[model samples]
Target: MNPAPSHVASRRDKLLILLTVCLAAVLLPLALSGGAVATPAIGRDLGGSPASLTWVTNAYMLSFGSLLMAAGALADQFGRKRLFVIGLGGFIVSSFAISLAPSVFWLDILRAIQGIVSAASLAAGSAALAQEFDGHARTRAFSMLGTSFGIGLAFGPLMAGTLIEYFGWRSLFITTGAIAAVAFMFGVPRMRESRDPNAAGLDYPGTVTFSATLVLFTTAIIQAPESGWGSPLIVGLLAASVVTLVAFIMVETRARRPMLDLSLFKYVRFIGVQILPLGTCYSYILLVVMLPLRLIGAEGMSEMDSGLLMIALSAPMLVVPIAVASLTRWASPGVLSGLGFLIAAAGLYWLSLVDFSASKTALLMPMLIIGIGTGMPWGLMDGLSVSVVPNDRAGMASGIFGTTRVAGEGTGLAIGTAILAALANTSLAHRVPEGGPELSARVAEAAQRLTNGDIAAAAAALPEVSRHALSLSYADAFVGLLHVLIVITLLSAFATFAFLSRTRTQGDGFERDEKGVEAVTRA
Candidate 1:
């Protein structure tokens, strides 16, 4: 054991961490900007009604959210390093398949495959951090991981927009595939086995039931506007969703190794900790994704211009890592989360009253303000969620937290769409009076066209007066979305206040050293 080759030893110790960060970074652009840029191209080549393009993103999200918990459990049972490598490989293959897809159906299949692989990578990345680092190294390791998430998120839109403009939308997948392939190769050899040999096996039955429940619920929400909430499909889907979800709960309670631990919620703080991620992540996706479309499609701005405007959304989070790391020391997590929510709500309220006809400058101010508010609590919420759980259950705690975040994001998108759809319908209907039956019918058709994602057709088919009126309706609908956002933010604030428990600023009695470094002691 004289001198273990210094370079090899150092490389072995750090290879897993480096690969994990790279794996996590690949997920962001795929999840964030791929759909926004690909929608038009996918719809055109595939020949589905323009409205079907929404499914491009919906398909990925549905599978991703549904399988997240099971994937987490799998990573903990098997080895994270092993699973991460496999996941990266699958993602690369699926991405290439999607790039070559001849139809929307094939593309959708590839997208679902991509979702499953991406979910596994995300789950394994968390456990890999725990396995690779100890003491203060773990703290710094996690911070680096968070930094990866932030940078990947910020870079996504810009990268996607440039690729789409210069080459084509498929470049999005090709690029992600290449990066993920590199990560897998670098990760396989040096990555050590870290899974607990004594850990319980996978819960297959619970996984199936829970996955079904999520798929059903998400499908109902997404189809409600299109199929009518009162339709049998919608009603049956919701009913089935509830029954399956309850069954999942029962199965988890009895499973030897449950994907989600039912007992974790008993800690009041555990429940409260879920709110911050839910609110912030939900608003972040809804606003950032929707704003680009609104600015480019509706406001007549170029894609580059719209992308530039949206980049400001990440500005608040840019300086937030240190602030979040420090804020937990000054007050309880509950108070900090509550303050963050209140600030977010205020920003949303300002957004709700936006003068749509005014300059874009007015809009950027609120967006930046909201970004600031949203960024403040990301880390503390994460800290609190994991802080309440035992060390052995770290993987489980992360699973539950990720599930809630996904659920919240799905719910937000559905709610935003429903509110906007209703406003658009009502506004259009009111302006075109039924007294002029023919004109009224034409106006209604135009409104329907707009909802179906056929903007050009809608404008061409409408009368001059009705064209002006429909624009007003679109404006009104955007306002409605802002109001809904404000209400949700306030609700999140109240929930954080009510549920999050007070914790000592130093976090679980782990004091900082004389140099002011807080060691990552076991929870």
Candidate 2:
């Protein structure tokens, strides 16, 4: 073949940057969901108590979500390319170390490290694309990036199940490490370095306060089910989180160059765009986190079978981004996002009607509807978040967007899990009222086992009569939780509709003056 023209070569290089960064982004969620499917096998091999296994997921989410904004600021102040390379290197090392872990302790520690570094890679990679691409190219780039994320989420379970069934659970980490290493090799050589020239010094107090607040808040939520919500420890953590959050706000308002410019909140459209991801992820992604466990434990499906069923939930995301991107020419982003959330809320309502006895086939239609609805706004929200801000602060905007996304996801998981645990325990107690302390203890143990995706072990721990009752309770609890989540999602959809509907179609601008920030006239 003839060598490509210089212009063509330049285009290819830009595309290569997108390709490499997207690949790196895929690794985080792939690793997350992959671990979800393989949790049973991992617990069995690692021999951890049920509570210990929960940390495998919680640790990663807590670390990843909390550090996102700080990482974004660091990338903007330093160099994006440099941060991206370092993050990738750290992720690769953590993955490898996790694969070689001798115990659950090491695995959890390494997973937390993976989450921390993944934040750096995600923020820098997103900022890099936003800075490099513009106009329609920016739209297309974000759309493709959203598709890549959807693909990873959609296929992660299947890949994890297959790996666990044949090669063992360790292979999941090994595979992730290998992929990150390849991305690193490609990215370090061709990636163009960029940073904000006017970026100010790091806001140390703000970073500490913000990160500490998230950590404390997320920890309390994750542990609320085990330690009663009103327990001293939970209350203490909640109080600390509130105090730290206030400190963060005060620090940001005073800092010469705040880690997150509070002035961004003045743009109504920016606030709406940020809320879009949080609402969408809360309604849609939480299902992605819980459905696999439901299938394997309550529904008595194999890991591979559960993974296949999850395709019903994830498959629509693969194509919906491109479809929505095209639809934007006719409809405003607000209309599309609002309509999408309404559709997703409807899907959740439909799912709430499904009985515990419903088969995987029965779930297909509702799951597909939810997937389509959620996917519509996925890429649009991401693009709007960066577009509304100055290009120079793309890194910070990207970080904030990512922080909301992961934080929303983590919060949803915590809330959903808590509701499930509460309802299940209540149902179980009612069913076995006269069974005595021993049986109640066994039932509690079985519930924990089920949450960890060990259906067989949970069943074996109970009498046949108790087992049947337990399954019924689980089903009832799941249906009840769905009802509660549906209400929350509907309210969020309405709020999204209200705010987004008010936004101007043409882009808006921001101007910083000596004393105050001004919103430029919309074009």
Candidate 3:
């Protein structure tokens, strides 16, 4: 490939910037989901328990989601190019370091560091794109970014399976590190430096308090399934989350220059944009994290087979966002977003009806429908979220949007797993009522294993007569969880529809201030 154009002044330079920024976006999800297919192998090799293995994913998410706003604020204060290069370098180093981690503890710690660095890269990279593009070009640039993100998510499992089969799980990190290093090398000299000239000093107190709130809350959610929800530790963590949240709000309110401008919440349009991603990502995460496990464990498919099947769930994401962006001339973004949520809810409802004994092909239509629906709003919402804000605070808006996306995925995974575990246990108890105390213990063990996507172990642990029943119970639990998700998604769809219905035009609900910066207002 030829060298990337030197600066953003020429048309070719603009395309290069988009590609560079999208490279970062793609790398984030690639690093995140690349390990999905390798999780079992990692656990087996590292001697990690199911609960501990989950932290391997959650640790990355917790740190990534928690630091995004602060990272964005820093990017705005410092130059975006400077922070982007630093973040890319950190990601490269941490990715390499993770491959050398001797145990799960060190791996999780390194993954958390990777997440922190990823936050900086994502926020700065996105801000750079926003700075480099405008109008229709901006729309197309965001669409391409969304497409790259979808491609990463769509192909991560396939890549992971192939890499792990050939080179082992360690290669995943090594490959990612090498890619980041290359991107950094190109990004450093070619990328133009940009920062908010009016930005004040970093809001250290607000960042600390806000980060504590997210950490405590996510920790409580992750542990609630293992430790009883009513446990003192869980309760204390919940309480601490609340306290830190209040402290964060107070700090932001009093700060001369807040990390997050709390006043943005007053805009109904901004609120709608924020909620759009949270709702869509919740459902998307469930599919991404759970579907592969379900195929491998419940359906007895090979990792490669499962990865191929996942294409139905993610390929539409690659195509639909660009298509939706093109439709902007015909439909308002609010209309498109609300319709997307409704369609996704319908898809989830359809998925709830699939029979457990059905073949993998039976999942294709619902998965495709859900993928298309999920893709429809992504680029639209992403573009609007940053564009609606002042040009200088684009980083802050991008950070908030990215934070919601990661936080929603983490929250969904925790809740979905808990629901599946609880429901499976309940079904097992009902079906095996006559089993002795030992049998009851065995069934509980099996349910836990099933929740972790070790359906083979779960089945093997049960008596022959109970094995088929266990499969049915697993199916029933999944269906039950799907029903719950469907309901939540439908409620979100209704709210999105209601919010959008109030607007008369594409930008009717927002107004430009005296300085020509957009602000949210009533239609």
Candidate 4:
């Protein structure tokens, strides 16, 4: 037989490299999104406070989100394949361990470990993938990784719901672990080792400061409803987060080899690329977690029903490749991304107008619209992350972009949960007429339980209030939340367009040569 063309062999190797990372990508969302679908069920099985139940999801995100930049730096300092093996090894162990957690507290701890390991896996895998591809081939590769990620989000809920209903919630983790293990077996041998040659050492000071900032910020958000936003603890947390964030910036600026190059912010288009993930955090990620809780908790939908509804919201991701191809052909990325954000904003507005009493199907159209809009940017953001930076700093690009996306998700989810709970508490405030401090505390606790879909517990706490009344209060708060989300989405759309419209061939001040060497260029 005739030997295969040289290009064909090269293409096959690239595909194999991509498949490994794509597998790694899918696990992040599956654990986050699919794990979210199991929250209510998990809560029912292992009774805990609403905050604890939220932590079931939040713990994984917080740990994963906070460590991503450090993980990226490690991948660069070490070898990508080496980090990949260590991370996956730990991840596999944590997944099975989390399945056996006897209480919410233990589950939270194990999930946090799972998240940390996942961060290492994702950042290493992504940076490695970027190293292997160049030019348009790289764009297509990242797009495919994005699509695999979308697949995990789009189907996670449905799979979790079905698994929880029949096999129990533990089955979700077991299944994810088994699938991830299989991917590890198939892909590891094929993945060539890669790393950033210019990596100076791990930026310990920068990593510590950055990690502290997120922990403090997320803590403040989660504690605001209970401690009161003005409480000293919450005030202290917010203040400390700001201080550490400033410290991180100062450290990065002074360091010879910063984990994030502060100079990149000078480029208008690079700033816009960073904003893309921030937009999705509010527009898409928050919705994926919030909508399911609302469906099951407020509307009393079954696990299966909520899962099907989420499909409408996330299913548009299935067409992300087609959407990217068509939209990019007809318009510049600025137009495509900006238009997508506006579409999502419109969907949020339409959702706000929807009556709670309307059929679940009433949510389908707007949810689908929101998904389509956000899906437009989903595939492009990953490409833009590395494209804007120099070829050598691909590791930093992966770290910074991944941090923004994951950290933003963790931060947004905390804020969304707090705001929604506060709104519910406010709605219930009038109902607690003639109450003292003790009663007020009870009301606050009940409000949290109600938002988490634990109506049975909330009703017990407020025996005088009917379950229907509690549901109505939760629904009222949800509508108000939607209005807030709409405003955020619109502002994001305007900012995306304004910043991205000014893109240069190199978003920053670097140009690539035939061998992927980078040199400084004036903008």
Candidate 5:
């Protein structure tokens, strides 16, 4: 066969990559946010204990967040294309398996596998795209990627809800898998293979310790309400999590080929980049999970109705990020991101004050504000994450940021859910006449069911507690959670403005190479 012109080949490759990435971005968050809305359906179809059902989300978040570091390193060591293909293949199979799952136990296990492979594909695919652009163009590409992610999150609930309403909950998984398959097919033929020969092998010890740390800590948080925070098992898990975390830091510092370069901590901008995800976790992600619970469980809305209402909360993400990206020409991303947070904080505070008894339209302004605020930082954070590091370390940078982002969601979900449950549980216990220690476990379980948007299940668990009472208690707890998110958003805004600098993106940038030689990387 005759060789094609270089420019023609390049254009073809870029187009194919764009298609695949957009699809991947959409499907990833579709699975996460969509699954959040689908929980009530899952619980109804497959009966399981409250703890087991929590694992339906936790299992995926746990594995996905924990293994990202290793996947990034593997991408750099092996070929990026090679790992990307493998990851997508695994994702397709696992998502399909999840669709046909017989019980929640199998679903949790499959979701875990799905998360693991997703880490691989996300790290490799993002790093591969980074290799193709530099300077403002790089920022634009990543901004596009971020926008695609927003679209997924924006539509995930409505799409999933609509699918579950008509087809079945299982169809959501099938849809995710089918979209992924197209990305695989288009990307495989046109994408060029690349790798960093300098990358050291995966740090197995670091992976194990880090994974163990998350497992122990998240388990402790999720199970604490039922078991009691002071219970021996919960205490032991917390202690072990602390120990493993310390061990992970030690292992990374001492290893010749650490999965994470501890040196990245020294850069203020890098630290700022990491903070952006955590900020979004509370301000945005928490809302995506909990709002549905309130709408469906407390307000007695159908899946389709709640999903439609959610468009107000998530729709700003679709446009605001792109606007912020363009606005960066006039303002530093730091200033824009911080401003966004303040806007979001304003919305969150308003949302807290708004009476749930009012029409749903009253909810729109605050949700839109919150989405716009978070979107500003969201657009730029993706580019900044990799831009702060050398191109050679793109996989590792993506991996580290990916880990922080996903792990934040995992921990945030656990913390947010636990807090909401605890508050509601206490409210329920108080409502119970002469309720004592014997009533605590059932009340806690009922509270969890309430937060999961299973008000009927919650009422069933606490037969003595009126369904109306349970709904009121949950609404109060959710509103309180919103107040907490507002404060976090404000802090995030201040930190963003204070810590991030234009130097990382526009000024002369340098990083020490493997041999201690400082080299100027692309701005």
Candidate 6:
């Protein structure tokens, strides 16, 4: 075949790469937000039980988390471009199947498949650019990648809400599938094939063992609230998880090409740099997801209004990367991560102070402050993470780093949700009481109403005094969620400071080679 015009080919190739990268990292969140809004509609259409609706989310998470480690190794063995195309094909097919799902059970299964496929694309995209470029160019490339990540995160919810408001839930599946197909077609031909020729054979046992460990651990954590920590199911799962995780570590250490190089944590700088990104996800979920619910249900605000109010959190994230990238020239990642945690913690503390009657405008200041705080860490973590690791390990490091962030987010949500649920139940139940049979029945009914998101029903069922008390209790719930956010942020700050600090002496012997950035270590 005749070689294409150089400029035209290059432009086409770049477009394809950018499209695939954004789709891989951002598509799931966009689909998730849209799907979340459509849970009611999906349940009604499929005749699904209330319990089954949660699967629309859980299934995706399970698969995404399940395949993350394997995807990184696959990208290194199979060509990055080749594996990415395969994953894209799988994603599109699964999405189409989900759109045509006959029932909720089928939809959940397909969503899980979609998650597994998406993780491959995500890992490939992160690794591809670093392998494709040299030294400083790679750093610039990662900045662009980080920017795409922020843009996708910000855009998904807004887009999802608009789509769900107009088209319906299944449209999410259709739209995502269409985008994946187009990107796949455009991406496959022009993209360069980049993979580590020196990489060892795939470590199948390590992949299976690690995946099982994560599954069992997450299941145990998620189930403990409902089943009781002492329940046979919870205790058995937890114990099995510990054994499997230990086995995974041992297995990876001995495997031909370990899915994850546990040795990365040997570098104190690398370990410290990751804590910020790892913990940032937790802050992201609480501020964006939980805060919105609190605003609408507890504070008097419409869903749209709450969404608008919450956009401030993301707005700063968009700009922070530029700020953080620039700051790194002068300061180290440790300085950046430590400062970021402090700012985020301050924002959380302010958030905890907002009461039920607080004004929406009053909430904006703290949100903006937190956003500014978050921007540095968000940007700094990505740049520093790739910078501190060796070229060959970039793919592995990115995979593990991203997984840690996701795990932190999942755990944070579970912890925050559990706290809010407990406080809401206890405070409301006490306010409603075991009194006269008729009064007691009415109060119990109101408590159920509050739990179910029917604030109006709860208000109407309670006596005037009890109504005021329940309102106060809801305020207490918001306070509790905020406190949870505060505690996490504080712990994150300390982790960043104590574990992240380094002297300039240790940073002297470092330089980036043609393949990628140089490794930095701590004193």
Clashes in predicted model 4: 1
Error of 2 at 54 (Å): 2.5
Q: List the residue pairs that clash in candidate 4.
A: 297-453
Order the numbered candidates by lDDT, best leading: 5, 4, 2, 3, 1, 6
- Residue-level lDDT tens digits of model 5 in 404-466: 989989998999888888888877878788767767778888888887878889988899988
lDDT of candidates 1 onward, in order: 0.69, 0.77, 0.76, 0.81, 0.82, 0.67
- lDDT of candidate 1 over 1-523, digit per residue (tens): 6566986787575866565555565465445555664565455456553234555666676677777777777787888877877777788898888778888777777887888888888777777777777898788777777777776666666776677667777777888888777776676566666786776767888878888887787777766655667889999999999999899999989877677888877656667778787788555667766665566555656555666677777656667646766766667777777777788778777877887557877777777777777876775766666776555555577778888876666556555655566666677777754657566555555544454344555576565545556667777877777787777788888888776645543235333452222222212
For candidate 5, give the lDDT of residue 169. Answer: 88
Return the TM-score for candidate 1, rounded to 2 decimals.
0.88
Superposed model 1: Cα runs more than 4 Å off: 1-4, 7-9, 12-20, 44-47, 356-358, 389-395, 433-454, 460-467, 505-523
> After superposition on all CA atoms, how large is the RMSD of candidate 3?
4.0
Q: For model 3, how does the per-residue alpha-carbon lDDT over 471-521 read when each residue is reduced to its tens digit?
A: 788888888888887777777677777665444333343345643323344
Clashing residue pairs for model 6: none
Which model scores highest in lDDT?
Answer: 5
Candidates in order, TM-scores: namely 0.88, 0.89, 0.88, 0.91, 0.91, 0.83
| Model 4: residue 404 alpha-carbon error in angstroms | 1.4
TM-score of 3: 0.88
For model 2, residues 1-523, the per-residue Cα lDDT tens digits are 6556877977878888898888987887887787677667778788676656766776787788878877777888899988998888999999999989999888888888998899889878888898779999997887677777888989888877777777988998999999999888876677888888877756789878987887788778767665668889999999999999999999989888787777767666667778787777667877877787777656767777878888888888888877887887787777788888888888988888877466568888888889888888775787777766566666567667777788767666666776777787677667654777678667666666666666566677665446667777778878887888777777777877776764534343445552323433221
Candidate 5 local Cα displacement, residue 108, angstroms = 0.9
lDDT by residue (1-523, candidate 4, tens digit) is: 5567777877776777788779778888889987788888888899987888888888889999988888877888799889988888788889899889999989988998999999999878877787888999887787788788878898888887888778998998998888778878877877788877877768899888988998899878887776777889999999999999999999999999887778766555667788888888888998899888777766778777788889988989889646675656556676677888999999988888887567878989999999998887776676677766676666466667778888888988998899888999998887767788888887888888877877888888788678888888888888888888888888888987887653433344454563323233223
lDDT of 6 by residue, 1-523 (tens): 5566876777567756766676666676655544544444465468553224445665666667667767877888888888888788888999889889999889878887887887788777777766556787666666667666676656655565455446766777788889878877776677788887887756788878877777777666655544556789989998998999899899988876677788888667668766776567666654555554455454555544555676777778778868776666677666777788788878877876865475678788788878888777777665556555665566567767777766555455545555565566567667654668566555545544443334565677676445557778767766776777767777877887776554222223345553223244433
